[model samples]
Target: MKVLIIEDEKELSKSIVEYLSEENYLCEVASTHKEAMKKIGIFNYDCILLDITLPDGNGLKLLEELTNENKQDGVIIISAKNSIDDKIKGLQLGADDYLTKPFHLSELTARIFSLIRRKQFNNANKIKQDELEIDLLAKTVVVNSNPVALTKKEFDLLIYFIGNKNRVLSKSTLAEHLSGDFADMLDNHDFVYAHVKNLKKKLSEAGCEPYLKTVYGTGYKWKG
Candidate 1:
């Protein structure tokens, strides 16, 4: 999953990024409200850790913008303020959860997982499609009761395809989703083709049907 940490405290942002990266989440940080808005305008994150206070503006304004844009990203407010009014305002602004500054990283991680699950999978930990079974908690994929060994990128690619099944996905879209902010530095999407090829080969070897289809002169789609 991808996460955006909108925090001004450098140390706290670093710690959160390190801890969440260890938990297999792709993380990006924005210290100011302007930077946060830029990132939000360009990329789609699975969850956002929003701090109410920022150098440029209040995080609540960003939340309001997200609501106005109809963005589906799950947001969790993390601030030092514990006042009931602030909490109520944050929730009313459409935040999924709130965490005080002096909180455990483990608890924060659990909250992100819960928020993503509720938003993406209807709170289900396991996703079963035909002979394929994916355990979101375990981060494992199995086909026909046999394990499929997929690299982290490949697994992420598979999940992305499954999540948007039957929709035509451009190479640029896949590249941006996979590489996040770094995608702009990339000159081409050769890596997208490579990951899709590897994923298709692994699933084919595991006796699964060819659900991934390539659209000539366009991009790719998951027919599942």
Candidate 2:
């Protein structure tokens, strides 16, 4: 999944990125509120880790912007402040969860997973569509009661498609979702095509339905 980390603490942000990267999350960061706002305006993220404190402004304001825009991106407030009021305000504003600083990386990861599942996967660890089955926690995919081996990127592509099912996803959007900030530096989104092609081939070979559809000059859609 894609994530935006709006944190000013450099070391903490670095550590969080490193840990979440190992979990296969596409993460991008913004230390200030303006930077965070710009990124959120340009692309959608599956989850956002916002700190209560920023160099320019309060993170809660960012939450307000998101609410005002009616964006449904899942948000989790990660702040050094442990005040009950802060947590309450965050939840009141629109945060899905709150994590106090100095928390365990494993705990943060678990919370991120939980929030993503609840928001995107109907709060189920296992997702089943026809003969295809996906275990979010186990990170496995099965088709027609048989296992389907997919590379990490292919698996990510599958879930991304399913999470946003029935929506037309542009190649640039897929590129950003898969590569995060690095997508801007990449010359082209050929990788998006390559990965989606491989995923389609693998799923088709495994007897899965043709849920993936090409929209001509547009992009792809999961026609579920």
Candidate 3:
């Protein structure tokens, strides 16, 4: 999974990035609202941890920008502002969830997982498509009732593909999804092909169907 942490507090953002990275999520941090805007304008994430109060802008206005762009990226407000009005405005503008500061990272992680599931997998802990089964919480994949071993990056790639099934993903987008915004700093996306190749091999060896498809010169897609 991919997440963007938008907060001015260095310690909080650092802690979030560390915890979520340990949980197999690619995370990017934006200390200011302008930085957050730049990242969101360029890349899409599975979830965004937005702080309502920023040094440069209001997070609610960011929500409005997201709504205006019709972006489907899931949003969760992480703010110290506990007023009902702020929560209402955030939700009214389109935040999936809100967590007050001084909150538990575990709880925040749970909410993020829930939001991603609700947006991508229909709120099901286990996603099934034909002979393939994925337990999102367990971070496991089974094909034809057989467990498939995948590296962390490989597993993340699989989920990214499945969540965006049938959509043609470009190499750059895949790179960003797998490597966070650092993808922009890379010169080539050979790592993307490597990960996809490994994931495909593991799935095929596990008696899985040919769900991963390469788009010639473009990228890859998951087709049911």
Candidate 4:
């Protein structure tokens, strides 16, 4: 999953990004409210870790704006403010969960997983599409009841496709989802084609129904 970390504390933000990246999440950091606004205005993320106090503006206002825009992205407030009013206000403004600072990283990770499961996957750990099953927490996939050995990129690609089933995904969008916002700095998207090809071949060889579809003149889609 992709995540945006909006925190003014540079060290904390960096640590969070590093930890989340180790957990197989695409992470980006925004040190100030302006940067956070720019990121939310441009790219999409599966979840956002928002800090209520920023250098420029209060993160609560941004949360309210997100609510007005009807953004489906999951949001978690990571702020030092532990007042009941702040918690109630954030929840009222559509924040999924609130976590005070000086907490365990594992707890934060678990919360993020819970939020994603609740918002995107109907609170299910295993996602099933016909004969294919994906265990989001375990980061594993089974085709026809057999485990499919996939590279990290291949697994991420498969998860992305399944999460957005039946929706046409352009190459660029897929690349961004897999590589994060920095994907645009890449010279080419040949890596995307390579990973997609490998994923499709593996699924087919495993006797799984072919679900990855390439849209002519566009990109690819996962169809049930």
Task: Summing lDDT over every window of 10 consecutive residues in candidate 1, give the lowest-scoring window.
Answer: 156-165
- Against the hidden reference, what TM-scores do the models get? 0.96, 0.97, 0.98, 0.97
Instruction: Please provide, for model 3 over 106-162, each residue's C-alpha lDDT reduced to its tens digit, 9 standing for 90 to 100.
Output: 999999999999999999999898999999999999999999999999988888898
Candidate 2 residue-wise lDDT, 114-136, digit = tens: 99999988899999999999999
What lDDT does each candidate get?
Answer: 0.92, 0.94, 0.92, 0.90
Q: Give Cα distance to truth, residue 3, candidate 4, Å.
A: 0.5
How much is 17 displaced in model 3, in angstroms? 0.9
Ranking by lDDT: 2, 1, 3, 4
User: In candidate 4, residue 172 scores what lDDT?
Assistant: 91
Cα error of candidate 4 at position 114, Å:
0.8
- Deviation in Å, model 3, residue 132 alpha carbon: 1.1
lDDT (tens digit, per residue) of candidate 4 on 164-211? 889999999988888887788999888889999999999999888878
The residue ranges of model 4 lying beyond 4 angstroms of the native Cα positions read none
Given candidate 2, what's the lDDT at residue 64?
91
Measured by lDDT, the strongest candidate is 2
- RMSD values for the candidates in order, in angstroms, are 1.1, 0.9, 0.9, 1.1
lDDT of 1 by residue, 106-218 (tens): 99999999998888778999988898989988999999999999999898888788878899999988988888888999989999999999999999999888889999889
Instruction: Give the runs in model 1 whose Cα sits over 4 Å from its true position.
Output: none
